[model samples]
Structure formats: C-alpha cells, structure tokens
Target: MSDIEVIVGRIGRAHGIRGEVFVDVRTDEPGRRFAPGGTLRMGDKRRPATLASVRWNRGKLIVSFAEAPDRTAVEQLTGELLYDHVPEAELPSEKDEYFDRHLVGLVVRDHTGAERGTVSEVLHLPAQDVLQLDVDGEERLVPFVSALVPTVDVAGGFLQLADVDGLLEDVE
Candidate 1:
C-alpha cells in the first residue's frame, strides 16, 4: 500500500475469535517484524493501517492492524501486506555490507568481471538468503553469504561475489 514505508510483516491467517494474524517476515534480521506498536499501510501512499497488536507465532510474527478490532476485520487482511517508513537515521547497515533492498536491481558479474545477468529478486531461506538472477537467457541462484558476495556497493547499487565454485553444478 502507498509507498509501503517498509514491510513490517504479512497476515498469514485468522487466529482466534478475538482477532489475530501471522507474519512471514522477509527481512535479513529474524526479529525485525515484531517491533511492538508499529504501523502498517494497506494500499496507496497516504494513511497506512496502523497495528494495534503484534506477537510471534511459530517463529513468525503475528500482527493486528491498528484499524481492525474484530476477527472479520483481521480476516479481510489475510493476504495483504504491512509497511513502515523507516528513517535513514535508523538504518543498521555495517561496513562493506548493505541491506538486501540495495541489491534489488544490479548486474551480477563473474570473477573476471563479465556480465552474468541482472538481479531480479532476493529470497530469504531459513538457511541462507539467495539472489535470483536472470542471466543470458537463464536464471541463476547465487547464495547471498559473505563468501559468495564479497563486495556490495550500496551507493553504486551493484554486487560483486567470489567465483561461484560449482555453484551452478546442481542447477544444471
């Protein structure tokens, strides 16, 4: 919704009769979704649906939109999203490291610095997050760990990784 300040989490399913939902967070940090008393916008760029209640469920966080006070209200948002506009001053980036958002649109290159493809999306797996890329008419899944992605220039919006050793062997 709106600009989606930031996706705090998502509504998984209806909880109990009172009102409850679940969130499968996609952030690099596991606990980023359950930041208590946060707000989420549904759609558009104006007033987002504020969150009234939030909790964790089976490692996933459950959030109740501030605007919804009943089970029916929560059910209506089962498939929608939650967002927050985190200020720049609040970013927790570290040296030689950048958030996954910065790598959304960048060219992936080989060790020789050859164009392999363009990154399309970033996936967060329980083990590790991977980059989904489209290269030379083929899709490539590159691991997003430090060993693979050794360098990330956030301002430049590009990523450089070590030679993917047999990384594509299984993909073949």
Candidate 2:
C-alpha cells in the first residue's frame, strides 16, 4: 500500500468488557473514517488491525479492533490518538473542493507576497475550518474559504491568502 497521509479521528478510551473502545470521531466523513475491516492508529503507533465491529451508542462510537483481544489489552490504549489512511479514490469530487488535510504544510502568504507561516494544523468549527498557523511562537486562525484563502498551490507548497482585515493583528 502507498504511504497516504494519516487522518486523525478522536482519541478513544477503552470501554466495557469484550475489548470494545469508545471513540469520539473527529472526521465529518465517518463512513470512510470507520470503514469496517480497515486500519487505524493510536498516538504515533500505527495499528494494523482489521476493524472487527463498530456501532454507535450513547453518542460514542464503539469499535472493536482485531488486535485488542481482551478488555485488559483495550485499557492500555485509552486516550490515544487514532489515525487512518484514506485512499483518494474513496473521496467524492466537488469542483474546486479539497480535503482539509491537503492544506497542511503549505506555506501561507499575503497578497503582497509577504511570507506568513506554515500551517500547523486544521481546526473544524461549526461555521468553517480554521487553519492553525505557527507564526513566530504564536498561533493564528485563518478562516478556510475562497475569499480569505483565495489561492492554493499544493504543488508549490504555498498558498496566497487574501488580506482579511484585522485577522493577523489579533489571535482568538
């Protein structure tokens, strides 16, 4: 398999007997995130277990990993970051749309060709996805949209951000 970028779901805690884990999903696309018989990771450790079973109950996703043979083993993985590798073919196409993960590591720039910083992470909010930028020991949130972030050249590993008024002046 190709080395696809890891997409993180929420960290999970071991729940109940039977080696079940309660995972708080982070991705909007749960079907791909929790596809039955797929692989997932905890923290930096890549788990190569087939997903045995998964179900939603009480607003928490309960997943049974093939490697977690018993409740004791499940308890050890509590509160670990879960990562999944999703294939590009599984994603649907929308004109001019892109996955948020594709923006990571892209250099942020202003319209005047001023260098901003590299994107550290992407934050999903109710209204829009925010690009977390590490700018000189500080973090800034740039609203992910066409108006503010008008251009992105993933090939060049940089993006041109529209100068939002007061956006860079303050941190929220």
Candidate 3:
C-alpha cells in the first residue's frame, strides 16, 4: 500500500507548567492517533515525535512527546503540525465515505454521460465538503452530497453528477 502523510494535529500553547501542550486535533480518530507511544511527524521538518502521554482537559486534547520533556522544549513545538503516515489503501470504515485524496483525481461526468470536469480538490466546510472541479480550465465548486454527487466509482476513475440547472451552466 502506498503511504500518505495526513495532518492529525497542530501543537498549540503549552499547558500548565509541564511539557504537556494543547493540541488542535485535526483527525477524527484522535484516540488512536494520539495514543501513547504512537509516532507522529512534527512540523515541516518531519521530525519524529513519539507520544509520551495524552490526556483531555475539559474538551481540549493535551499531549506530551517523549522528545519534548519540559515546558521549554514543548513551547518550541507550538504551531507545529503533527502528521501521521498511513497506507493510502486504507478506506473509511463506513461505506460511501471517501478521503479527499481519493476524490481529487476522479473524472466528473453528468448523468447522461456527458464529460464535464476533473475533481482537483476537496474543500471541507463546516456544513459539508465541497468538490473543486476543473472544467475546461475553469474552477467550479460542487457540494459533496448524495443529492449532487450521486455516484462515485473510484476504481473506475469517475463520478457521476446529477444534472441540476445552472450546475454546468456556461459549460454545456
């Protein structure tokens, strides 16, 4: 399986007077990702960081790394992004759920088999995920939902979209 580095968290401010620091968790599976002994690459340098301890304060995730033993050391790590390398073959446990990377390169077509565009990016908004389509060099954003994106065939390398008026407006 190919490996993909995913951002799991970002180091926040130092917590209390120890090396423990608040983490702005980015992954849904924080328990598994931030579990003690789990190794996460820290920052753009990709420094190896082993989780020494993890706990929750109120609703915030507080973590300490084996490499950063004291407040001084952990403070330096503030604002650093934590990344976890995982297999690209891994799929979401639930059906129909797709990782952004999986959809990025898929061809988008209309229901009647009209070629439309290619998915270039996936934008995660508070309400829902949005697909960024590159149609004839023009960019369009489509909300990622069953109503709009009716079908997805990752293996087939394509996805079918429902023909809503104005959806493919200026294109055809």
The lDDT of each candidate is 0.67, 0.76, 0.89
Q: Which of the predicted structures, 1 or 2, would earn the higher lDDT when compared with the native?
A: 2
Candidate with the greatest lDDT versus the true structure = 3
lDDT of 3 by residue, 1-172 (tens): 6899998889999987779999998776787689898899998899999999999989999999999999999999999999998898987777898877789999989889778899999887779789999988889888999999899999999999997766656655
Q: Which candidate, 1 or 2, has the higher TM-score?
A: 1
- For model 1, how does the per-residue alpha-carbon lDDT over 38-125 read when each residue is reduced to its tens digit? 5556644434676677666576676666677778988877767656665643545455555556678887776777766778888877
lDDT of 1 at 63: 68
Candidate 1 structure lDDT: 0.67
lDDT of 2 by residue, 37-98 (tens): 88877666665655788888977788888888678987887777787766744443545655
Per-model clash counts, in order, read 10, 0, 0
Give me the runs in candidate 2 sitting further than 4 Å from their true place.
5-7, 26-28, 43-45, 86-97, 112-114, 125-128, 135-138, 170-172
- Candidate 3 local distance difference test against the native: 0.89
Best by TM-score: 3
Candidates' TM-scores?
Answer: 0.76, 0.70, 0.85
TM-score of 1: 0.76
Where does candidate 3 stray beyond 4 Å?
A: 56-59, 170-172
Tell me how many residue pairs clash in candidate 3.
0
